[model samples]
Target: MTSEKRSIAVRFFGGAGNYTTVLEECCTHILTSDPTEAALVEWVKSNTKATSTDGIRDRLRFLEALELLEIEPERVRLTETGITWVSQTDPNVLFEQLDATVYGFETALEALQNGPKTDAELGDSIANTHAEVNWNDPSGPAQHRGWLQSLGYVERSDGLNSLTDSGRALARRRTSDSPNFQRQTYYTQADLEKAFDTSFGSYIKGINPRTDDHGELSYIIVKAREDGPYSDELDGERFTYIGEGVPSKGDQTLTGANKALLEQAEGASVPVYFFYQPADRSDLRYEGLVSVADVRYVSADERDRRVYEFTMERLDLEHPTEFETLAASVTAGEREETDSDANDGTNAGSEPEPALTAAEDEYTEVQRRVRSSAFAKRVKSAYDFRCAICDRSRESPAGTVDIEAAHIYPKQENGRDFIRNGLALCRLHHWAFDTGWLAVSDAYRILVADRPELEGYEEFSRLEGAQITVPPAEDEQPHATFLAAHRELHGFESV
Candidate 1:
């Protein structure tokens, strides 16, 4: 208890600088060669010139005041707020940056979905190719690239660049939010195989087959052209032998250099697609072939341009492939078991699924809910689609108006998981509400009485008397009974 008091005292006196110093020490101590309290103390002493235990405790309390350090027994760690501060200095600025990175991420992802690119290639491949990045300024693309790399959105591969899955997910979210772009870029069969340098079924789709001359034709699955068996015109009928292994694995289907060449040669941007045909050795067995193609470029810079001439009719969709059948069967079985359990209440106390599976399921559910068209547009409507805290609107380019549905009584707290228990909050308001620094009252007004720093925030000051955005229908108001119960449960006054 003495140690705890001493630590709090130090944190109380610490300023932002001291907080930074202590945080650096904690990170270097926790993440480096040594992990000991003595080592951490020595590191802090070097920065603050404090020797005695009392001096260290004083500095630590100061750091706590700055919100940079979290104290545990014999160890210190940086809080999420601290990490955000250290990374970008201002949480609001960092959030904006994250949003911008997400936008740029969408543009790059379209290219990646079409084909692979080097870092330089992706920067060039941005859809707004004509716009120049303010390289003379530090707050520019170069800086943003570093930020993206730090956040695990973009990655380096053999001097080339690629998008991580999280990056793709973010891009999809941004794309779904905006309607300017049609479909994310598509790739040809040959290009698709070349980009990944590995084969995976999930990433490949939209195959188109074509033939080369001399009756020595090749198949262009989407944009990927594959050399097929040689053929000759006989009696106006062409007899051809679709050769096996026309495309060797080592072929350079699409390269950064290749994309650059196309950009220069065309004098206009072209959508890219990775293309490939199956690796079937037998001539007759090429019937049920699959390939991956992404549509990245559209002709004439118009939304209505012919992106692809082929549709489902041109492609063979009658036969389900081996992988397709297997996946379908597994999904069917799982659904059956889920339904059976739901009805009979069987296995009521069964152990939970594996951690990885559970996490994946949760992540998938979150993504699904967030990306749904109706939910994406209306989530903000519950709060009148404006920020319950900041009231920022989509009209302001710098400010985001989109709001996410947030829990008032946390879902984990046995709060009813319904709209009445939820508030449509902008990202900033969402963070503040979730952190317990602010909350809504039973009267549907904002409250920050316990949080002095936040109490004077614009939302609380100017908007206190303003009713939060209510549902269009009167019946859609938060359940009065639930609100009463919640206020009673939390010891909050009705007003």
Candidate 2:
């Protein structure tokens, strides 16, 4: 196929790797509750840092193209086929669907069927087949290679290209009518359990049989430190955590295991299963198959040693029980049931408990504590307990740092208690952010509002137009909408 055709196909069909995020978002929103297009867009913008509606529209269109979504004039919902696709535990089936649906994929496969060919040879073959347009450009064949590799159909070794067993099978069974078309056996959960054998040990011990390129086991054990410098918690379809870099004896550098873990995570092409163990117990509470969503390198101490911070999205499962409990606590008032009280015999005619002023106060306090604690944990972990505005932090005696989580939009305004709505700031910067003196831009540049009283203050003046310390993932950074709201609230112009 020609490059123009390929480009058009990509625009219509969506890029190979790009579909996963949007698909996950769709499944998440649909499963949570049916949401309108506007609600989906808003949720994505707030949670995923999506800047425009076009990306969302294109994804929705792609889903419709693939027959995964049933789009009506006013609403869109998943089709039965789409629901099955999302619910499947096997990744191979998802790969097969992509290979079968992507535009120009079949033609590219046909070209590679005869024999192993270099990328240039494949491009030349495709170019010769279509004389109407140029396919000789690097991007033309590179796009094909990318799709094929992402679908697990092809591999490259020593600069030579070859088809995997699945690729060979796909090539031979090109026609949809063929019995073997897009068919392959996959490992079942029972099979994995049998092979790994967790009866006498933990899930971590069970999955340790497989090893990866980093000379470590295929899976990494993440201990959820809900109360410290390195912690982890789940938020909807994603799990956020601080990367491991606890100081080793006699040296302040990162641990060797952590270094290897970071390298593998950073370079991984496949999803890695993370077995999450709670702080109080050593046994595994839950396991999530995740891909690294974000990573940031931050200074570990005064010695200038650096460590990685991670944000991971769960690709294979729903939220665990612990996450559900925490989520329940944060949104308490909305879901609390008063039916029992209303049906009680003694309280039926007794003024309906009169709002229980003290109880209401206590409930509000509990909500704030739960929401703030979770929000603070995520924000502090994201920035490695360093201030975004001033880049200062001190270790507390309890192993926690002195940084605070400051909300860009206050809770009274119906702002969500999410990572995007928070920033890790030192005590001084937190005060400045709460007041009108300091604000941040969507671009993450520190904007100091024109304050006549602080004209001679070097500490405040030096930060004007300075870039704040942001998370590695674009989506985890402070959202532009929240930043805009903060700026407007503080009467600050764009810097």
Candidate 3:
């Protein structure tokens, strides 16, 4: 088999770098009984970590391409070739078949056997054999080079390319399998931090890690700002953000960055990290290893452009205590400066706010005002100063929003001032939530109390069954116990 044949086979398999596992699973299911497309899709969703139907469909298409499974109008069934492929004990043979069918491998082997050649040279040499591929097309050559490197058939050094020992052996037909070949593995946040040992920005710019032919892991740095496209909130356990469409840069489309980010989230083989820096602070305060929890794309500034409304959950890890401390200090300093300015007749004509009555007093005794400020800043910063419930964020004259951090469990009821214990909400939603007119289910769905007073308000009624915005991290989610206690107290049924 030649590289061109291998390339065709790879394309037939939907251009997936790793199809053996998916094939095995698909074959096993169909072997027992023919399953409907919906059934198979549901099975993939339930059994595997795949979160979308599109991903499952892609795998099914790959199986179909390889003649491993035949898709009828109603159901899918395995073919003889698929059964044989599934029963094979060694995957090396399957890999060999793929190598023989692919297009660039032969050119790579030949070039390496003679002398070292750059990716362009190899691509040009291969282009002579394939009429469809143009060597001048940057993407085609880049992809060929990438595929060769990923298979361990080529090595690059000092802007020059050469063959590895495995590459040489592969070229000489000494072995069907490359000695250096191994499947890509997921890396934890600690693993990445140790590997880079630098600021998140620097790491992202310097190194873009890719597994197989999938896209590179995008290292996005979100600077917390009022009236920005996204807002982020962090509890000790998780970091959450709602991102809108990124603005276009020069000739770039508005949704370009957002689309890429969403793809990274959806197709990511490894966990992605989000490093958030406060607008008022210099250092990145939160570093969270995250996964895409949800995605909803909507029309943005232009008719063609779309904004990605999404959420990310933080992996379980220790809180960055030092970062939190630094953030708190910055908040305190800002508050002091604001207070000083106010005292210096900055608001001379403004009326003094009415004091809270004894009966209406909340957080006066249980939560220290200064400590609460820090908590509010952290929570609001995480959510980008937006209301988590309504997504209502507006910049004030002072370049801040009117959002307030409402405790999920009240401080007076022994709820500590923790990031997980709070939610950034608009005034109305916060008041309604605190007064038991609104409550959240354990699943984060909004539950309205059966009250006559709330019936006429269309806004409140419309939100009756909607889910509240929640932190992406499982640990940062509103505690079930807290929600249950609130529901029980308000005479609502448990979720």
Best by TM-score: 2
Alpha-carbon RMSD, each predicted model = 26.3, 19.5, 23.8
- Stretches > 4 Å off in candidate 1: 1-378, 381-384, 388-391, 395-400, 414-417, 451-463, 481-491
In model 2, the worst 10-residue window by lDDT is 176-185
Q: Candidate 2 residues 1-495, lDDT tens each? A: 112223222322234434454555566576566777777667767766457788867756656656567666556687766777778623345445444554345666787777777777777776776656554566666666755665557777765567765566556545422111011233333434563343324333312324445854544434353344444566666655655545453222334544444443423322245554445654344455444555456665676655555666654323222222333444343223234323444644652221111132443432344455456666777988799887889754323355777777766565655666778898788888888778887678887767657643566777888999988975457766678787888898754
Question: Candidate 2 has what TM-score?
Answer: 0.31
Pitting candidate 2 against candidate 3, the one with the higher lDDT is: 2
lDDT by residue for model 3 (1-495), tens: 222342332221213223345556667888886798888888777766676787678657655654567877588887776677678624334445444545655665677678877767776777776756443554455455554554545667765677765456455543222111111233333444554453344422211333333544424433333334444465544344545334563122324444444543432223344554445643333355444554455444553554455556554323222222233334444454435433654376863221111123333321233344466656766666678778888653323345777877776676655565668888788888888888888788888877666554555767888877776764445556567767877788999
TM-score per candidate, in order?
0.26, 0.31, 0.27
Residues 1-495, candidate 1, lDDT per residue (tens digit)? 122111001221134213333444455554443334555567667756456876766655545444555665566666565566666543232323344323344455566656557656655655254244422222233333444555445566576656555555444444442112112233443444454343435443233222234542132222222332212111111111121112232222233333332221211111122223334421111222222111122221223331211111111222222223222333343354335433553366652221111122422332222222222233345557666556655532212234566656565554433344556677676776666546566566665534446554655455444555556654345545454444555555676
**TM accuracy, model 3:** 0.27
Backbone clashes, candidate 2: 0
Residue pairs clashing in model 2 are none
